[model samples]
Target: MSRGSTLAEKIIGRAAGHAVQPGDLAVVAVGMAMSVDSIAPSVIKVMREEFRIPKVADPEKVALFVDHVAPACNVSTAEGQAEVRRFAAEQGIRHLYDVGTGVCHQLMIDRGLARAGEVVLGSDSHSTAYGAIGAFGTGMGATDIALAFATGKTWLRVPETMKVELTGQLPAGVMSKDAILHLIGRLGIDGATYRAVEFYGAEDLTAASRITLCSMTTELGAKAGMIAFPQERLAEFGLPEWLFADPDAGYVHAETIDLAALSPQVSSPDDVDNVSSVDAVVGIHIDQVFLGTCTNGRLEDIHAAARILKGRRVAPHVRMIIIPASDDILKQSVADGSLISLLEAGATVSTPGCGPCIGRHQGVLAAGEACFSTANRNFRGRMGSPEADIYLGSPLTAAATALEGKIADPRNYL
Candidate 1:
């Protein structure tokens, strides 16, 4: 007489006032719906055609952001943003954010738009980033987003749950990003397909660490990602404490990853799951070092890199770029002197946006050049030209590589 476990199940169970079991088809009410400029216009189009409505069911519950193409790169992007702005105004939406606000995922959490235990749907893949703060947030396509806007509800088949318990303390210089890369390496790309990954055990769940871990679940092909919150952690965000899971709660699958022996791990070019330790790739030539993204762009991540690059100048032939996740984080870095250290060490500090991570607007590489990035995804041409090579690693490794003008281990400097 036990209920099945899944992320969609848990959200539907709480939203529908009934305990939902896996494999069940359910219509779940949502607490919030969000979209960025990249996909908001398409969702708006779908809403106009499908619902024939100029407004959403609840405008206040919807959020639109211009973070994806902030500062408006070209005429096309600018027009897209203008359309989103016009739609928000026409629909009377109140939570719309313009440029300079920050990235959508960080802005959503920082602005208190996501509440604990509520179902939130976003149009961006990184929507799972909100799960770090205890909200059940996930991504969908434009059509699904439009339906959610029209009805404040969406249909989902409850997926199974996978329990990932982390035991043992993370060694110094090893971060949550490294931990996740380690998991991807072990599980392969299809490891958690159509399942929810729940992180439990040991380390206190900090906002930064949770974001780092959950943001990369896409690499494992997870449908949704989550972590349990301790009471103190909830209070930090001024939210009510909620129960995560009972001691007797069951999971479809359970696995534990021991991090005591883990070193800095890197997902090599062309494959996210193709992981190797820092020692394996040591001395590889690197042309660039990038430190920013929703995953590793927090103040703590920046400080970790700064600690390693404090007085050392970047290699003359290497290009190092630092982009904070938000304007607030950028300001904090300036106040804490991390910005100065980065600049003094010959690293370029870019605006608070996802630059060079997506290879869209900034830091595209030349043929055969190599880069070590803190962003997620290491697929071919992810950061720039298809011919350019990219490597994914923690901020610490990226910074050390910038110093040596190649892939060097941080322990070398320590």
Candidate 2:
């Protein structure tokens, strides 16, 4: 008799072209390996010195994005981006998304490089964002990414699956950010260490929400996170799937989230797991509101903010910054007038890249400032000064906070 396999085991086994079980070490072919501008220079150097590889094994499957510091914040960052561009050009890498494109994860999905049942690796921690479309995407160190570029293969141990079954409907005022923050609060930051999180009963989740959920799994120490069903646009990738777990699939642990009970949630300053409802923390003043990142920078997120900001202006005391995740999303917002609404609300619209998420030049917080952002992490000093505070929330919450200049419930604005 054969043992039942979880979705993680099934996908890893298929990618490895053999049977695999949890904890089994396997070398599997990779569908894609990517890096952003900040990491690509080191990755390319390692590939040149350590491997001495002449050409990449599959240039078509390798990508580099000039997103982390797109449009070059300074001479140093510009030089880094130039090196990445030179390497991509010399190596014949076909999928390089240069300045003005977008974040690496969004570009991977938009270009069809990441798809269901395929394994994708990136140098950034948020590489797991690709899991939103059912790909087994995870972060890799520079050495592993360099090797993947040279050989198109990477090794890994099959991780156990942790089932997170979300039931009931999300309330109108609450968003995916609230649901994920609620989960993190319940499970803690280290709850699913080194395990694949498989989301079930999320049939109501939109593509944007699913992406947001999967992106934050990294904060919970998950190896990867995924929703079980195929995305509506999955067929466009031309990939095969063994995407579902067996009926009797084994999981290391299982958790159920009742979405009906979750309200608008936020991660308070300096800790992602320190979650509380918006009502609990209301009236705490904010200096800025950032409304974009790989975690929540899609068109849907922009529209959500726009719906609340329509015919309204941000508070005089608050500085609101909005950025789109990709060029396509930016164009969509423009075509649909969401961009105008946001701008009319006194929000500053930046380029289609990682804006202030990395604490780079765009909107770095001054000391003692408090920022409400849609980005994933909220550790101390994550957004510039160690003295500044960061609160992580949904776009709805961020927009509402901008209007009120405080920690405000999006429900009131909705």
Candidate 3:
């Protein structure tokens, strides 16, 4: 059988300065290593023990953020932040984003910490977001990340590629998150395990939406996620154009999806791949609506929600919240009118942070209460009490649900 070129293969190939073949072992070099407060301390301990070095290879190469425990909700979280602060100072890492910065992924991309064709790894699964900028990025465990910190290298088993050909325009009110959810429904949660997904054939996606799509590949258990570099898209980042694949590039698996017919899809509570269209449960009531996360918390996502909620108020029974991905996004939204629109609609706007996504500091849900959110994970008790129900969707769907106080099809409002 002929071998296929996966995105991971291509990236590892370039990083190792060799043409990577399928099943070949490669030692790839990464350009950046990032961690959030939840995982940074553990990685620091591993670096100290395994590397046997008092400090990291390059402190600036490690970017740390406190977004996971932002605003220091309690004494324990405050202590965690203290530990991160002391470690950063001791390691001399200058790119630390403290309480005010935002979600680590958004900050990294917004500040140009990630560049095209470079290998970037993070302790958070949504690290795949950098693929939107034509970079090869993925998430790893804290121990693996710590090893990368010590040696500036990591071993990878080149994975097979899966080509997801997205044809046709997305339906009105349907965004990339819905599209990905629909895919998960068809492929199941473990379908892409240890493989790379390369999205192609959709030419109309904005750079922000493309990143949102790639970021969720982690939910499918993909090794990494990437998109071909369209010149116009690359230009948005002021990045140089690069070829993602040759015309005849091979793929182990290929599937074509016509997105024009897809509806606003939702992943059921607790299981990411248990997807159903909004039509499947049209009148389901929800207690909260959350719009923000590494996946869909970018400026464009907020603008999309604001357009839908501009003249309306959220349903009286629902508590709506909007969290921007970063402080810069928050500042821009304030200047651009989206923030005011959200507030006018009776929605609370939070500072840039992971917030309710991690279930630690903000927007914890009561038992049996349901929420529609834009965050990536919806595991059991991810947002609060074990009995709370969490539905995952795009920011557009989340906003519409807030207005309707139920699982809603955003097309009605759009």
Model 2 misses residue 330 by how many Å? 0.7
Q: Which regions of candidate 2 fall more than 4 Å away from where they truly are?
A: 230-241
Can you write out model 2's per-residue Cα lDDT over 343-410, one digit (the tens) per residue?
99999988889988879968999999999999998999988999999999999999899999998988
| Tens-digit lDDT track of model 3 for 1-414 | 545445567677888999887678888888888888888878888888866666778776788899987988888778878888998888888889999799998888878777678789899888988877777888999888998878778888787778898999987898888888888888888988888888986447887888888888888888788887554566765655553565566778888889898889888878898899888877789999999988888898999899889989999999998889999899999999998999999999887899899788679999989989998878899999999999998888888889999988888988
Candidate 1 residue spans exceeding 4 A from truth: 3-8, 202-205, 230-242
Lowest lDDT block of 10, candidate 3: 1-10
Order the numbered candidates by lDDT, best leading. Answer: 2, 3, 1
Q: To one decimal, what is the Cα RMSD in angstroms of model 3 from the true structure?
A: 1.9
Error in Å for residue 90 of model 2: 0.8
lDDT of 1 by residue, 1-414 (tens): 774344445565887678877677778888889998888989999999877866699998899988776777789989999999998888899898887667788878888887767888899877877767777778899999999998899888777778888888878878888889999999998899877788875336457888888888878888778875544556765554543554555688887888778899988889899998989999899998999888798898889899999998999998898888888999999999998999999999777777777777668787899989998887888777899889999998888899999898887776
Worst ten in a row by lDDT for model 1: 3-12
What TM-score number comes out for model 3? 0.95
- What lDDT does the true structure give each of the candidates? 0.82, 0.88, 0.84
User: Residue 116 in model 2: shift from native, Å?
Assistant: 1.1
Q: Number of clashing residue pairs in every model?
A: 0, 0, 0
Residue 281 lDDT in candidate 1: 90
TM-score of each model, paired residue for residue: 0.95, 0.97, 0.95
Clashing pairs in 3: none
Q: Which scores greater on TM-score, model 1 or model 3?
A: 3
